[model samples]
Target chain A: MRRSAFRRSRGDAPFRLASTGAGVVLLAIMAAIGVFLVVKAIPALQANTSNFLTEKIWNPNAVEPAFGIGALAFGTVLSSFLALVIATPVAIGVALFISHYAPRRLAAVLGYVVDLLAAVPSVVYGLWGVVFLVPFMRGPSEFLNTYFAWIPIFGGDQVVGKSMLTASIVLAIMILPIIAAISREVFLQAPKTQEEAALALGATRWEMIRMSVLPFGRPGVISAAMLGLGRAMGETIAVALILPATFGISFEILGPNGNSIAANIANGFGEATAVGRGALIASGLVLFLITLVVNMAARLVIARRKEFARAA
Target chain B: MTTVQTGIQPISTGRRVKDRIVQMLVYLAFAIAVVPLLSVLWLVVKNGIGRFDLEFLTHSMRNIGARDAGGGAYHAIIGTLEQVLLASLIAVPIGLLTAVYLVEYGPGGRLARWISFFVDVMTGVPSVVSGLFVLAFWVLALGMPFSGFAGAMALSILMMPVVVRSAEEMLRLVPNDLREAAYALGVPKWRTIVKVVLPTAFTGILTGVMLAVARVAGETAPLLLTVFFTDSINNDPFNGPQMGLPLYVFDQAGRPTDTAIDRAWTGALTLILIVMLLNLVARLIAWWRSPAKRGS
Candidate 1:
């Protein structure tokens, strides 16, 4: 018995080592990324105060240079938030239809189509936005400018063309498929027993979804939003093509100009100095940190809700 | 009379109407969601179809071309394929092995938890950040020049997490009974995993790989950062300006020329076709192994 136990212990030794080795690798990758960003960002942060984060002007070439990512960050977050607001209700509703209400064949077709949209490249979206959506939105911007002109956000000097609103609209379209797909998966995973029980208890089809599907899918919906937020914040080609602002928080949502961190990086990276690269790295670090937090929160929501699902 | 009428009609009638409205609203929302999709597809087809031709596909793009005469997306097509394929070679093995370690070997251990966290972080990374990260390290830190190789490296960062997660899920789906059978026959842990669990999950694993490759193929940010998009062909992944389909669309669309715009539309259509092919392969592989799935 003792000899057999020793043999087994020997067998387990390599397993333990390999697993720990994998752990070290993950940590190493994370450390490498974290260290590089921090070290590179140091010079940029020193040259300008951390408050430069909020500074609106981005003249990298200026002696005693004035640079700040405030406008870009605001533009990114604002457009993403706007997109979330526009996409959420529609995503949840569509998900509910595909998961619970649609005929099986129709649901399959719908699911396949949404997946196709998800696979469409971001650059294509940029191209379409530039050619078709921008022109199409001119009329809508006119309408918004006419009716909601009193609202500060709607109160933009319309360049008689594309603006921040156009960017937000494009973002909304980009994130729609992500939100819808995740929510659809969540609704599909809702407890079959609970759904049947709801129906058995004289619940209507809608009522069953309201009670069972919504609760079950809450975490997944939040995760979906986090994923979409990450995409919106980090988006490049589409935002670059459409957002027209140089950089800064404008009160107008429909103005034909604005910029995001992603657009900033894409537009300036080629021309930027080491200092410029450092500033962009700082911006990237902040973006990375934000995404990490949001993802953790999303996963925590799912795991925490897991217990409740299992119990009910 | 109103009270009497309400009382006379079953309350179920009101409930039924409410259900029907909810159903209608759900369907309406889905329909509206499809508008952008169909509109974009329609526009791509309309504008892109005009640029499709044997010569247009075969020839390299020229900056001096006239509005009526189009060049080609040949260089970009080659660049996109080569960069993506190279990234796959780097990412897939490491990712698959890591996944095998997590599922079959690591289980719920501390190492598994860390791997899981990093994998999640990797998945949420914005494509722009991946490009920047690679730029920070490769261009700045290492003093390496920009090339398609750098683009491939950035793409691998994005591709790795998806492969690890998807491949892990498939590996987990392999029946435990198979592992036990191998063990009962005196098979080693590594051997059993390689022969039994892996073979069982091969189809699903292939599906994941296909999907990951397709997803990475469309990325514009990394290609923009690491490989300078040019009008002419460049074959070397390690040096010079390279053409890539997504970048082609970006560059040509930015130019004011009608001929460039036409080429950009064609590139977009071509990208869609490649993506569709990947999806089809993934589906076919997955369906073949799934008894519940019907052949398309």
Candidate 2:
């Protein structure tokens, strides 16, 4: 609003100071989290017998206390990447359908459905994944293994459902709504004049979208995918409930082997000792860093897009 | 070559076929997306409806065993409400003031940019990591006992960003003309915000706050470490461990027996219903408050 008279008043200083204090509280909280995690994680790192990054074993509670994040980090990256690969195209397609292809009423209903899917708690997804999806996925896992055995990741003899593939699928479902919602917003915001120009030419519907909408939404799609990737990497309850926890890092996605940092912490923390709790906190720091990098990268992408759009 | 020589050319068979195929693919994609959601809701309702009754809502699982039949989520319901209310009490004021600062005083300022960036980063922080932070700080370093208060603190960390972002959007939507009018009448900026700007954005702020509450109420990872999941009722959140619906569902689902699994499904159903109710109310309030704001 136009606050010319208010701006001329002398009382603006105190209000500004009060709001700045509130803003500083947020900064303080973020700083405290980083400092606390580092301070608490140091002693456990000092006590470790194995290399914290490269070793594959986790034994923080043992007398010797050998521990590493090799397997957990591997599984976290692998499943999250797989989830992004599976969810990105489908989410983009659904976003396109809702924004362009569907009729108005249907689009509204579908959008609400997607929002409801997002509202479902992670624990509920965990319950559904464990109760229904795990057993249901066995047949598909077996089929994939039987048909695609030439592929290394699908060649494992044990085609048990509770494997990396299963966890990735669950993560895909968990993240689909977020990607769809974000991209839908982006797609809906495409310039109408550009779409009309493409259509006023002799272009088909799909051609119009490709020429006008897709190019406009490219940066948005990237940031949305990154957001989904961040969530998949840090998701705790669903992956914990589904993936049969294992410490081995193998390429066989169909094999019964997987572990993520957040899942490991959630599964192991209840009965942990002092060092074990510290070790989990140390791993949590790693998780925080990964998420932070991903989120910052996404924001960088968005900020660059805004500069380009403004310049253009 | 013969078809597109003129300005108003006829549509070709090849182009028509491509359009049909792409349209079919889009429809197929939509169907594929909806399948998992439908199946999850169907299964929860199918399995949980049998146990979702008055007895289940009223009684507690105090004396129930793996084989026993009768139990309820009365204690968990109370615990979830108390913890969520406490967390909202802590988060809403800070979040609102920060948002007010961003919109009213520091739009595009250096500190505002930094604050907004960290808030976005905070939004992506995992629920379990927040739990770990609280465990490391409150329970471990400070030697505080595990209780619902600790869980509320962790949940506040998660809820504050949601409230800030949503409330910021709402505050930005308030018209500049209104503020200008107040200023023209010789009113101070703070009074204008308190008397005029806030009232205009109150319903929007309420919706945002309620949505944040819904989200944190369903968070189990934080409570797993903080509240620690008791079976019996604990009235005081400051003194003792408390039962929450999400934690109860997780604990029940971990059991090996069929009855326990059944209860887990029922608990999941209850949690979903609670979240759905809050979401519906939030949406309803938004819709009721702004009937003219459509589509966007």
Residue B72 lDDT in candidate 1:
86
> In model 2, where do residues sit more than 4 Å from their true spots?
A1-14, A305-312, B1-10, B291-296
Q: What is the interface RMSD of candidate 1, in Å?
A: 2.6
Per-residue CA lDDT of model 2 for A183-240, tens digit only, reads 8878888999999998888789999999889999999889989989999998998899
List TM-score per model, in order: 0.92, 0.95
Candidates in order, interface RMSD in Å? 2.6, 1.6
lDDT of 1 by residue, A136-193 (tens): 8888788988998988877866644568778877888888887888788778889999
TM-score of chain B of each: 0.92, 0.94
